[model samples]
Target: MKIHINQLEEGCILAKDILSASNKVLAYKKTIVTEHIKHALKAFLVNEVHVENLLEDGRGFLPSGIQKEASNEEKEKVELTPVKTFHQLYNHAVMERKQLFTGWQSGTQIEIAKVRQIILPLISELKHQEGEILKLYQYCKKEDYLSHHSVSVALLSAFLAKRLGYDQGEINQIAITGLLCDCGMARISPVILTKKVTLTEREYLDLKQHPVHSYNLLKSIMSLKEGVKMGVLQHHERMDGSGYPLGVKGDQAHPYSKIVALADTYQAMVSERPYRSKQSPFKVLEQIMQHDFGRFELNAVNELKKAVIKFSAGTKVKLSNGLKAEIVFVDEQFPTRPIVKIEKTGDITSLKDKKELYIQEIF
Candidate 1:
């Protein structure tokens, strides 16, 4: 029976493994729970668990008066707000993307309409609740990195496009471009994709071929525009002629491709991968500002910084010094380091002057 984590009891056997938000197994199936195990689950932020061998009541250890089940209509009628709806849609997109990639690997014809079905609703929902969408970016799982990264790039691309004052039609097209930019990964081997160690030089070279592969697949779609095709083909191409496939300079690359590239890099850095833990958004932004100015188009990076600061300012955060604080202001000149108000003493600290202090996490 499924039960809340708080209801978990000693001696209860796990029916299934408990997984973290990143999809890593925390507790294995058939493991008997003990007091220490319960504490560990709480520390892992687990919300629910499945227990085997229920008592005669079938409800097991659930407190009295709690409903065991809801009516079909009641369950089906649960209203989802824009953000909640986006989560459901994102999960659907990930599963569908997996199937779509498998079909592509089998040489099946790629369908542009199916891609639209996955991206259009997300774009529409983002127009209403962009902040919620930004907040959800941090929840992307490491295990399903490909699909989650695709969705995240699409969202960030659309957000950046809007910030750049792109028209509605342009925004939708950019979002779709972001969604399929990495579809070429379907042609790569799963072992290379999920390697826990650093890839060798040859493996990295083969991995870089994905952009060209993606372009070849996307070029066959008659419905895709020239700009969209180029975006997928050159999303990895850098402004300084340092990217793969074409090595095109800033003037040589398409503007849409540059936007997607910026979004892609940001999403990849902030996401947890098999090889490395996730970095804080502030750290990623700081790195981009300090080192990536010449590699990415200036306007695209600036717009991304603006979008990030707009949503991230005023959020409660943990400081590097181990103090809890709430951001009070964001300086346009230094977007990464904002003014924060300490939670304990009501002291205002400006991160700009205090270079030693940094934000550790968003609470």
Candidate 2:
């Protein structure tokens, strides 16, 4: 039965998962209503709740005169408006980046005030709790992907910084730096930026210089911290001297830049693009850990690996081969590929041996 917030009482059990606009879980189903939860539901303007017929205290949830259940149409009407969730903050940041990117295309200088406005809320949300960076693909749109990529890179970079135990002040600087790392891309021609076909040699060379362009654009902003400016400039530099622009290797690249680079690379792989569909998260992680050794800092990549694919025994997951299974073991060296027991046949399979299969998703 769905009831109004005014009718909510302690001990009423949630019958369905309460989700935010972004489809993020707010309150899981079967959670018993508590005072704090009631207040949160009200603050988020959740007008209705689909609760079990009986309360936790063994009382009827609905009064005798009240409607026992709402129709499917009514259920659809019970949309939750989490105005202050990360979803809202993230969407606004994406639009803010879109507008800023457009302004940059026309020779507008980087506005530190507007930039802070975009970064602060996001940083605050990050401080509030650790978010699932793997789920950021839900917000990416191929048509406006540049804006999406900017915000996601910033978030992933910031997440890596925090996981690395950086202080809040350092984390804030890294977050802003990550967002502006691609600011140089604005200087590139739109024709080149959005080209669907292969780029000519000249165009490819020009695109590779974006980090230098980004550095020049940020160097003029006096209020920005020194490291923030440097991070944007060196984001593309690889640890093994394989990267472009200055081609600085090892410590020549700033530490913050390495975090941004790691996040930037990961986001690009998982996000959908016009030329190719997005790959599985496990697949991306597997490739990153297996193939991209020495290209990215081990500490940053390891932290991301631990956070994204935290393996535990008995965890239910769907396999790439379209079979359901329970994880039975996790090899620390290759966490992305774990040993699992097939659900139907009760047979064990080692993912490292079967190179073709990987985890599709966790249920």
Candidate 3:
């Protein structure tokens, strides 16, 4: 039975793992509770937990002494708005983007004003409630690739921009860059874009020209900021000089471009595509820090790391071994391998030392 943490008594067995806001396991299922465990739960900010056998004894309700009456004003202040509305708003934004991209493909001129209209409301909402926005993204399970990717990049870029200390106006510009960075993809043939098979060399080269296409399209927007235009143009450019269009390296690429590039890469990695399943965001972050270190800007990468940790810290995860666990801790030095508590056993394992274990998914 589910019970408030304050109502928990010593010797009660947990019926399910209690996860923190970030989805980390605060207490494992089946663990025999003790005073020490109760303290730990409080420290982790847990308010409720499920106890096995409690309901069977007809003791599911909170004890009278433990139940505190709340004033109507206080209850109203704490009431939660429905998250469904946010999801609907997100979906509407995506559909608007889809229409915008479709119009661009049909020879409609790209308008900065229209693009801003399509994204600004969503961006404002995200800025106000980032955690809720992230949770919606993580669990919504929608599959419209172009629109979903665009929105994801926009949100991630805005977040990174904020972390880098950009002013509000500049941050909004960065978001616009992310939203329109892949506008060139609309010019590509849908067959190639959604192909389940690998592209031939010529096809690959043709696909790589989207950034240039995006740049040429956006160049027509007279009121658009040069930095925003350049960000879209150079987002595919790499720090190690291995990126497409022009292989500018190091300081050659615009800072805003680097920010979009990192966000774009991360969003794409975690998103599902026709040819591959989506990867866990944590695993992708680890890969970026390890194998792709020099290919992305260090500052941008570091800021993104912090954002990912904040958004994913307490998320429930499944390991490669098929065991269900909750992430209890995220190690700064070894992010890919966070400490997780096994739900069934209450045993904590550090992914850093468990070379054979890795996170497979987040839920």
Give the Cα error of residue 27 in candidate 2, in Å. 28
Give Cα-based local distance difference scores for all models. 0.80, 0.81, 0.79
Q: Candidate 3: minimum summed lDDT over ten consecutive residues — where?
A: 74-83
Instruction: Write out the backbone clash pairs for model 1.
Output: none
What's model 1's TM-score?
0.74
TM agreement with the true structure for every prediction: 0.74, 0.73, 0.75
Candidate 1, 209-310: lDDT as tens digits: 999999998887889998989999999999889998989988798878989998899889878888977776787889988988799989888887777678
Report the poorest 10 consecutive residues by lDDT, candidate 1: 74-83
Question: In model 3, which regions exceed 4 Å deviation?
Answer: 1-84, 132-143
lDDT of 3 by residue, 228-295 (tens): 88999999999999998899998999989999999899878887776777777778888999999899
Clashes of each: 0, 0, 5
- lDDT value, candidate 3, whole model: 0.79
| Candidate 2: stretches off by over 4 Å | 1-82, 311-318, 322-329, 340-349, 360-363
